[model samples]
Target: MRELKYLNKYLFKYKWHFLLGTIFVIISNIFQIIPAMLVRDAINYVVDNLNIYQSLGQSATQQKFFTVVAFGIMVFAGLIVLMAFLRGVFLYFVRQTLIVMSRLIEYDLKNEIFEHYQSLPLSFYRRNNTGDLMNRISEDVSRVRMYLGPAIMYGLTLITLFMMLIPFMFHKSATLSWYALSPMPFLALSIFYVNNIVERRSEKIQEHQSRLSTFVQEAFSGIRVLKSFNREAQSMEKFDRELDDYKKQSLKLTKIQSMFYPVIMALIGVSTILTVYAGSMEVINGNLKLGVIAEFIMYVNILTWPVTSLGWTSSLVQRAEASQKRINEFLKTKTNIVSEKDLVREINGKVEFKNVTFIYPDSGIKALKDISFTIAPGESLAIIGTTGSGKSTVSSLVSRLYDTRGGEVLIDDLPIADYNLTSLRKQIGYVPQDVFLFSDTVANNIAFGTVDSDQSKIEQAAKDADVYHNIMEFAAGFETRVGERGITLSGGQKQRVSIARAIVREPKILILDDALSAVDTKTENNILNSMKRIMRGRTTIIISHRVSSAKLANKIIVLVDGSIVEQGTHESLIGREGVYKDLYEKQVLQEAEEKTS
Candidate 1:
């Protein structure tokens, strides 16, 4: 209930719909109670007139009386039918307003969660799994909607019916009313007990559901690996265990829920029996009419369904509360990276890392340690390193994907934080080491960074990345779908397409973090030649391990264990007997050996 308080804003947002729905509920209940009253009057009239009919038997006067009585009964029947029809009509209106409002709120909440997810920093993603994030927006939101729609509808109906029926029953016969309502307090206590258990089980069920979803998602995403390793049986056994656990939890909840209706029915049965027994005694004592007893029974029957539905409504509220709490946890998370300035600046691409140090927040691994470098506008710098030597971290800082933990990262001589975040990122073309492409056409993937890029630009960028002929060889050429994460394309083609995506943007600062690793030497050289033309007046940072790529840069820096050990021109680095020189010699020897073989 406390967690559900978060939905107050949404409730207020659709207050008009809620108000109209409430009005409909009231009207429906009014129509609902009128039928019982009509039945009461019809019965009383019929019972009272019985003796008069007997007295006038076998005469024209008797026939006239019978005709009048028959007509009166028909009129009561018609009015009862009319009341039922009107109740149904108002119920329809109630669903249209209340249920539709719930759907609208669901839509808004999902979008809000999605937008917040997008705004969160990369570290936040590292801290959370994809399946859990997906479940919060989808499954949890659906649960909250149940509370907003059906629970609210039924709960209101119960209150309205109770308010109308209870007073009417008391006004007619207080003793009969008390007998009929005697079971209500016990019913409430039973529901209270069940609700607590339901809430606890609902939370457990949701948590287990998230784990199951994550397991399935990961299994499907890595199906190829599973098949290759021949671990299908193991995976199936694990899935079975999760499924069994889910079943047990669900059954426990279902068992409790299953008891609810019977208990309510039992209570209702007691109320009915009590009303009949008490009313019979009053009638025998000549204190109450048979018609009043019938009316009280009708009232009790009217309340039966609403009272029975209390358990269901309570369960929905508990589930919704659990889900909303999960949703609020993520919504309350404040992103560490935010734009300090709203002014969009034109980037000249002078990137500088001033004694920067950064640690991965999730792992607490120091990726960069007191690293400093400058790439002047239109100048190309190559960072060469062994695996895990912080080459990629430099590129990440230049793009402001992360903020420095210790020192400052600057663009155009101003702190990168001072620039509008969107403007700064839009001007930098960053191709990461592990490339990712959407399940889309090759042309679309290439043109993704630039929303309005023409086909000519896409083709030109593809040619520049040395992947144009490869794409042309496909049956659909540039229009071919790349499948999930560009699975349809080869590794080299995917990397090249990623490069074309960045190229299409025509960003001022271009950082290729091992973007050409999958391409052959000949293809790499051709792409480098094209890049030389593109890099003439743009700042470029080429992060790679191969000397062939680094030799083309105007300056080269060698990294070792998260620190830069050497920095010089390519020719100077080759002349010196250092880490860079050794790497260059090793690569040259490997290329020669490959050619000989």
Candidate 2:
């Protein structure tokens, strides 16, 4: 019942259509049950009261009996057909409305979840699985469709039929009605027990379903890697184990269901027998007529269907509740990054780190400690360091992917947190170490962030990134679909496409986090020259491990152990004979040895 609260608003919003359909059901069932009652009256009239048949001047007693029975049969058949037609008519309209409601709810829920994803911190995404996130938005939203359709109407039908059957049963014999109600308490208890089991089993199924989705997604994504390393068979064995676990869990749930269903049927069968025996005694003792006994039997059969619906509905409600629990858990979690209200900032690429300190969540010590720096407009700077020297962390702060712990990262002389997130991101283009491409055209991939951009702009960006000629050589040219994550493209091509996407944004602050590492020397030089030409009046921060790449910057900052150790032009850094110079000599000697060989 608590799970229903989330759906109440939508139910009320579409109440008129539901009420109309319900009215049709009520009318149809009323006409449908009348013939059953009339059968007993007609039979009793011919057997016990022949005066009415004689006064009508039909025929002798035997002929009148056949005539009356034939009339009753015709009436019953017509009413049954009419009821069936009404059921079909209402079902069509009701299902149509439900389909619309389900689609609307699905769309709104997906948008809300996507908005939440956009607001969450990078730390959240780093910690969570991508496949789980996908399941939350796609599969979970779809689960609500059944709730709006069969589950809801079946519950309503069960409740209404239960209320109506009591009067019909008591009309035939009060003692029979009381006896039928006797088995209800046990039925309710068993339903409650099975429902509890269903909840646990359903939760297990959902958990394994998410794991299966994640494994399949990750394995398919890295199929090329596994094949190249000759680990395809090993990967398949792991997948087979997961599939077997899923199958075992599914069978356990099915076994529980199979047991619960028979228990319900057995309890129902007991009541049916008792009802039949009690009604038959009433007829034999002359307290009830034979025709009335027939009506009682019909009512008992009708009661049986509602009982089955109750048990079946209980199981469905339990499964839906389990799914609701997972969905609600996702909805209740708050994002670490919150947007400022109605905030926007015009950017000119003056970036400052003011007494900043930051620590990753669930980690000890700060990633950046008491760090402060300032970069003027149009200046190009390079950050160089060994792995985990706070170089990437500092770049992430500049892009406002995360907030600082102690102080602030200011852009355009304003605190970054004060600016609208979208506006701020629009002005700062960032390409991380791992490039992501959608399954779309090469032109669409390049012009992703720009709304309503034409093909010329995409072509220009591709040319700037030195990838235009390669795209032209493809069979479909610019319209060639980049396979999932651009799997069909080479690593260098993927990196170039990612760079082209950022360059097309025309950002005021451009960040390249080892984005050119996949390309050769000639291609990297061409892209560097393109940036130099177009980056006027904008700040550019390049992070790289290669000394050749850092040499293009006007000034270089070398980080060691989360602190800046050297900051100067390449010529000045080499003259100092420090860590930067030592790294430079090492690379130069390696290149010289390769050339001599």
Candidate 3:
């Protein structure tokens, strides 16, 4: 059986409900046992005398034999009806309490995991798949629920039946009772073996399931690219390979489960035959009373159900234990980023990188090394670099998405470690290169995290992002759902909506990390102009390779091999004729050559 120690906190929360449910089960279990004892008593009464009236200690001359038999029938009927009613009541509440408790556990566990995931650095998501994380919170949590709910009540029922049965068996016939229970140890050992196999098979199935989900998610999210590139048949073939592995795993689990029933039935068949045959011989030899034999047979029936259930419960408990280990492992994983106790919320957007060095979590080569720079408030600085030149790494530090291994990132001359994450992030407005939006209205998406954003404020942000007129043209206007990841909207629309979200935050610093990469020059210029109009007092840091965007910044910082190669306005950088100047000349020549062609 799984030790649910980690679940103690939640169990304590719902202790009262479990207590009431347990009370009901106990009452119902004891009441059900009364019918078995009553049957034995009635049989004993019949055995006392040949005359039906005198059998139960009634008057000998009395002609009330018919009435006595009828009264016995009535009493037996009442006991049966009462037992049925109580059992029904008990099962209902047991299910009720367990269901409620399971949902609560699921809610807390998933939410807590989400909170933990939020606290973790970006490197965690880079190492793990989004689909796998979703499955762990959704499917894995549900698996835990199965054990806590229906499985618990079944286990409780088995235990209660065992307690009531042993005493009754001892009283019936001590020698026969001992003989009847002699095979229990063998049964238990076999169950353990069966459970071990089931657990191993179940683990493989879960692994396959996660792999399948990941494949489907990636393919579906990139369906447009796949279709445009004519990779449908190729994608399908890859998906089938993953699905085939999943099918094999499922089949293996079923095969292991299939073996359990036969083994259980064989043992139970042996026990039942021994019980009946042994009791019959004793009666024939005049060593045991017939009433005792009858009662023993009835008790054997009661034991049969629990005996069969042991096999099933063994499989369930093993699966639950495996799931428990998996959940514990997830819970134990520590976040890469650590928050300090002295963190405050007093940043004024003066970002400083002091001899900072950072490497990806799984990499030996440093992505950024010996980087040092400072940007004052209200200054617009541009970062231009080749792919993997640590441009994004520097941009991410401003949001505390990655912690530097050497030196420190400071805001307002204080180390970023000194500022609380929530307060620091609130001061910065960042629109990521990959735009992600939920399936919700444009208004809601724009005003996502703003507490006091009314309709007018939402529209103002939209207008500033250069997406207001476009959103108004949709069939449902601002009420239209964006579809999954904003798939219903065009690429430019998605980018601008994300910008609108950042605009409404009214941040002290604005970061456009390739945010306008998807749009054409005309649309990009319009969005940039709108942004420039509203960003007078705030520090704007734009990271882009496009010289047009870079030129707009009052100051430009160019990076190469994780170090600043040059820092100046566009005209000054052009005057120096370095890396940035060469790149700018190449892009300008390419555009002129395209126009001539």
lDDT values for all models? 0.90, 0.76, 0.79
Misplaced by over 4 Å in model 2 are 1-4, 15-32, 38-69, 97-103, 142-149, 184-219, 224-268, 594-597
On a 0 to 100 scale, what is the lDDT of residue 435 in model 3? 90
Model 1 vs truth, CA RMSD: 2.4
Residue 532 error, candidate 2, Å? 1.4
Summarize candidate 3's per-residue lDDT along 501-545 as a digit string, tens digits: 998988898898888888877788898788788678788889887
- Per-residue CA lDDT of candidate 2, range 270-327, in tens? 7777766877787788787767755665665656655656655676665666666667
Which regions of candidate 3 are displaced past 4 Å?
A: 1-4, 46-50, 53-64, 186-266, 284-289, 593-597
**Residues 78-193 of candidate 1: C-alpha lDDT, one tens digit per residue:** 99999999999999999999999999999999999999998888889999988789889998999999999999999999998888778778888889889988887787778767
Q: Candidate 3: lDDT of 88?
A: 79
Candidate achieving higher TM-score, 1 or 2: 1
Ranking of candidates on lDDT, top first: 1, 3, 2
TM-score of 2: 0.88
Clashes of each: 0, 0, 0
- Rank all candidate structures by their TM-score, best first, as comma-separated numbers: 1, 3, 2
Error of 1 at 596 (Å): 3.5
Better of 1 and 3 by lDDT: 1
